[model samples]
Target chain A: MSQKVTRRQFLNYSLMGVGSFMAAGAILPMGRFALDPLFQGEAQGSMITTSVKAEEITEEPVKVDFSYEQQDAWYKSEVTDFVWVYRDGDQIIALSPICKHLGCTVTWAGDDANPNKFFCPCHNGLYEKNGKNIPGTPPRGPLDQYEVGESDGFITIGEMFENELV
Target chain B: MLYNQKDLKVLKDEIEFIDTVIIPFAAMDMDMKAPVHAGNLELLQIVCVQLEKQFKGRLLITPPMMTVGEDTSLLGMYTTQLREYGFKNIIVLTHLQAEPGDMNKIRLNEIPLENMSDDMKMEMINDEVKTVMKSVISIWNQ
Candidate 1:
């Protein structure tokens, strides 16, 4: 014989289902947060925006400072980087500001006597217009060069590869 | 470059070009409390690290020379040894003031970093490093 459903049993089943639904609603987000790293892909290098335009650049390099979001493990922060960007004919060249000698930032036309070259004030290091380290300087190599790209009048800089410039 | 095995490995054969040696001199007072002693040592380490980073290729940072009392003849002996090893510039960056001497013995520069904010300390460190760089370049030019 088929048994009739009692109100107490029906209410107990519905309450249990509702309680389980509420418990899952509280725990699912926590579970996802804990396991989110497993689903994340490898950290990819990204292009960063600069306040520079291709047409605005001239033979004399301009110092363009920009920042990017740097993700390190679980910590995230914004880091500032700079480059010396200038136009060489139709090609845009971007040189890293870091000096090859000791990682100090180099400045463009910093010396009054040598106004066309990049100068590192820390150790009197000098670099030529093409990012080549001048002989007799402390720097053992040339400044790094960044892969530059442009679209719709805006310029974006990619990774800086060391001693890339000729 | 620090006085570590990895840095030494690359620089062992290239010591002739690495002419500058930075000897960090900190005074370790026996009467002072442990925390104060630790704090001073830590501050000196930070300052030295920043200085080394600014002139890594040209400067070789030696292990710190600590003094428990007021004696500093050990620094003189150290300077002589570095000179024997062909380092042209042996700079003693001291928290405790070093004795003024002739240019050949050891160059002394006091970095009074006590009771300073981190920003101020960093600014002072950068300034000191720039000065040291200029002097080292002058020596190289000579």
Candidate 2:
């Protein structure tokens, strides 16, 4: 015959484990839920236009400059700036020339001799002419893309957010 | 504050002593495909890092404040922040690019030189100088 287990013994043995699990379930969501606002308030959209005539955008990528309003949510402000625009077909897109690694404005620094890639003078962040992150460079991700819209013969660009900037 | 080594050298080589540091609250280049100019968290990091290097010893680089960060309803907060800073540091505003709603990094620095006084204008030319020294200040503050 097997010895019978008492209800009191079971409660004493498992009480802590059950309570800890309950607490975790209650806390995890609340923690994540609270920080959602931070994510939502990252940054908002802006507009940019390209001087590249609609017919001028060739098959290759070209960097253009455009300006528009910036909607800051944290302090509730509206500012503007010019962005570098890249054109691919009728779709004219813009990317911030800033090196992704440390936020240095990677101007048209020209090409490197050995690799022929654009370099950031700040920390030597590298990017292909197309703005792709060079391997082993400080910038870990690809350049941010802009939304494009054409009106008449002119091209317009918008900000990129997450995957889609607009 | 934004600068490379040359900027710092120029300051030390030329204006060895600097009292007032004017950090222009405007993204230098916003319209680009690269992340650095995209005006995101990375932008803030880069700016802060640069500010630290330039103002490493004594400076006050404002927080990465975005004009578009808040809604129009809270413009007062931004104005207050400016006022809090004594409004002595003027804002070098820029013209907005078209289709701003679709893009995030179209912002660019188009400093209004005309609006600024002679002294204020000089501050911008040596902005890199300011950037380097302020870098030191930023590091200490953090």
Candidate 3:
């Protein structure tokens, strides 16, 4: 015995097939759009790589230069900034050069009197090796710290945070 | 700090701490030396940015002031206005030879930055910034 499909059944089957295809076409993009941020977050991780090698960081603090793209209003430019990196025992530490007093760049041993300390030339602010704000200085708090890690024997800098050592 | 709305709001109350103002002067003559003028303006801007970063607590950088040639007659009046606005020191940063009365003027070196590599440009700009910074510091010490 041979069986033949009815016209109504044929229409229902075709309609369901096309309807599901169209629905998927529309929903797939929306799903991707909803999860776009996750994809981007994985692709553009917060860590920025620097040129300095991990082994180059000694016990004495040295300036490590890093460049990153900066967006200001409608303009985009590559800005180069530096951080103070040093080796403390087996761990590496990075500190922001911005003074806590008033946003001035601090230097390592900038002031002659303050050897072995980060000194702010603008107002004579001083910070200890551990980023602690010394007494009688203009800095109100310790220097901010940056998340640091080693990748492929090179130093990679990440998000800045409050000084944990202090 | 910069001459922007947010900074100006804070500047009104903190004029005592931020007593110094840096005016970036540039020449915009549309002649054969237009490119040279443009290069000087770029170098001036870079130096000003570095200077601001070094002395943000005590310095306020103004917008670049453009003029045709070395006619700095308008600067005298501008300086008076700035002095009247409670700024104790008004330093003019430029590559031109201009005498804006008795106010301090820092004449930057005219380097052909366009003909150099990125690293060389940065090194040259940094040296210029250091010299300008030294002058500013000496003025402060005085």
Candidate 4:
């Protein structure tokens, strides 16, 4: 049997198609804009590019400060972070400057007597070259470590892992 | 450094290195008004945090001494206690216009929020706290 196509039916089908296309065109951009942040992953644990370069890292730990945008719901602000970056033979290490005993910022060599160790000026807490808490020191645990990734000769510091030494 | 268990332990073990103790003295005239007292307490806390951030290694921040309906007469007692704990340089940061006799006292007020936007006021507060803390550091050096 031959199928009959009426002019009214053909017009209805064409109008429906055109209406759906227009609706999609209007809705797609708005949908993407509303959901852009969700696709960017959760704001808390994202890697941020640092000012540190792989070539600049030496045996002596260098204090590198970087800022990244932190989003708390609708509020967004740049949060500054600092790390002690150094090279141990073939490996690159990035340690957080926060002291384990207290939240005081630790320095590469803040103490005159303990010039080779990472020193916390607040309480004289010391960490070894490998970020290990010196035995008999105030800090019971080692400094937190930043997961590092390298691309295009620049280092990207990621989420912190507490008590991660060496 | 703050007056927490971990920090106190650190202080006890390395008392020789420590020379300063910042005692945040927040005295409230509770009879005045609830909002006023709260505002005073809030500003004191902000100044404390700024000072701790600025001179973490050089000083220990004792838990705030908040005396409701009290005055600066208690300053002498606090100084004596802090001196016994081996703090040579004691700083009392208060909202009350306290006189510096035995210990250094700094007076600060909250940035008035009546005439500015919340964001602008917050920025001003931060700058104000930082400036006050820098002056406190200079006083400590002297």
Q: Tell me, per candidate, how large a share of the native contacts it keeps.
A: 0.17, 0.00, 0.70, 0.35
- DockQ, per model, reads 0.16, 0.04, 0.62, 0.24
Proportion of native contacts in model 1?
0.17
Native-referenced Cα lDDT, model 3: 0.92
How far is A136's C-alpha from truth in model 2 (Å)?
Answer: 2.0
- Candidate 2 lDDT over B1-142, as tens digits, reads 3244644444343232222233333334434522433433343344445544423322234444444432233333554554454432222212233322211122333444556798985576356334433443333233
Give the top-scoring candidate (TM-score): 3
C-alpha lDDT of residue B115 in model 1: 75
- Model 2, residue B90: distance off in Å is 24
TM agreement with the true structure for every prediction: 0.61, 0.37, 0.84, 0.55
Better of 1 and 3 by TM-score: 3
User: Model 3 Cα displacement at B30 (Å)?
Assistant: 3.5
True-vs-predicted CA distance for residue A109, candidate 3, Å: 0.2
State the displacement of the C-alpha of residue A56, model 2, in Å, after optimal TM-score superposition.
4.1
lDDT of 1 at A98: 78
Better of 3 and 4 by TM-score: 3
Top DockQ hit: 3
Q: Which ten residues in a row have the lowest lDDT in candidate 1 chain B?
A: B100-109
Q: Which stretches of candidate 2 lie over 4 Å from their true place?
A: A1-52, A56-63, A71-78, A89-91, A109-116, A161-166, B1-142
lDDT of 3 by residue, A43-102 (tens): 888889999999999999999999999999999999888999999999999999999987
Instruction: Put the candidates in TM-score order, highest first.
Output: 3, 1, 4, 2
lDDT tens digits, residues A1-166, model 4? Answer: 9999899999999999999999999999999999988976765446677877889989999987779888988999877778989898888888988887656778788778988999875566899987899988888789988888776788888888875554
